[model samples]
Target: MSRFEKLSHVIWHCQYHIFWVPKYRYRILTGAVANEVYRCIQIYCGRLGCEIVELNVQPDHVHLLVKVPPKRSISEVLGAVKGRTAIRIFKQFSNLRKKPYWGNSFWAKGYCVDTVGMDAEMVRKYVKYQEQLEKQQEQLQF
Candidate 1:
């Protein structure tokens, strides 16, 4: 009845707030691209036995609230999500890897990740509030 995931020797709730952007911080993650990135991340994380508690794919970046297992290091989790998503996105949308970009890389080299434990609600609200604020900013520009 407990919420925490239980391994043979451990019971844990390792949630993280992960944010990463596209190469050059391009606003390429829109419409189909955003959907694809979200789907790919969900699939990849699921394969790793990780649970995505919340996710938001912004125009230039992505924010994910994921529950990772202790068996996998944070770097390993990021590698899997970012690496696999990049490959799949490039393959599905060939134009992304062509011309001026001159490379198949999709995500930037680094990411920002923070632990979301007792303060999970605060993080969730912050993410939601950010999206709302961004929306408002866009409205003002037009």
Candidate 2:
């Protein structure tokens, strides 16, 4: 009935717009490389229990809209995704190793992440309405 996901202990809805780039910003993510990247993302996210709301693999960058669990920090989620994907990608596409990815790292040093949710005005309105409902409930109980 609710959009919230039920875990063993927590019910939550946390989504993130995550973006990252390849090492040296190269446009090598074309053809087979792109396909492999997509597969790697799907496998890793599935294993981590993170759902992919949407995923776009670009030549030099990637855009992922993912629903992560409350128990996992953003850093932890991204780290697992990025780290394991890099390993899998390189192992599958060994030619990429000769291109620019030194130290066996495919992605760049860091990534960009933003939360996806309601705007401030909506949240403020909801909070105000919630308080009013509580007040009405107290009156009914008396």
Top model by TM-score, which number?
Answer: 2
The 10 consecutive residues of candidate 1 with the worst lDDT sum are 96-105
* TM-score versus the correct structure, for each prediction: 0.80, 0.89
Which pairs of residues collide in model 1? none
Report the C-alpha displacement of residue 112, candidate 2, in angstroms: 0.7
True-vs-predicted CA distance for residue 86, candidate 1, Å: 0.7
Each candidate's clash count: 0, 0
Tens-place lDDT digits, model 2, residues 96-141: 7886446678899899999999899999999999999999999999
Per-residue lDDT of 115 in model 2: 95
Candidate 1 structure lDDT = 0.91
Alpha carbon lDDT at 117, candidate 1: 76
Candidate 1, 38-68: lDDT as tens digits: 9999999999989999999999899999999
Q: List the residue pairs that clash in candidate 2.
A: none
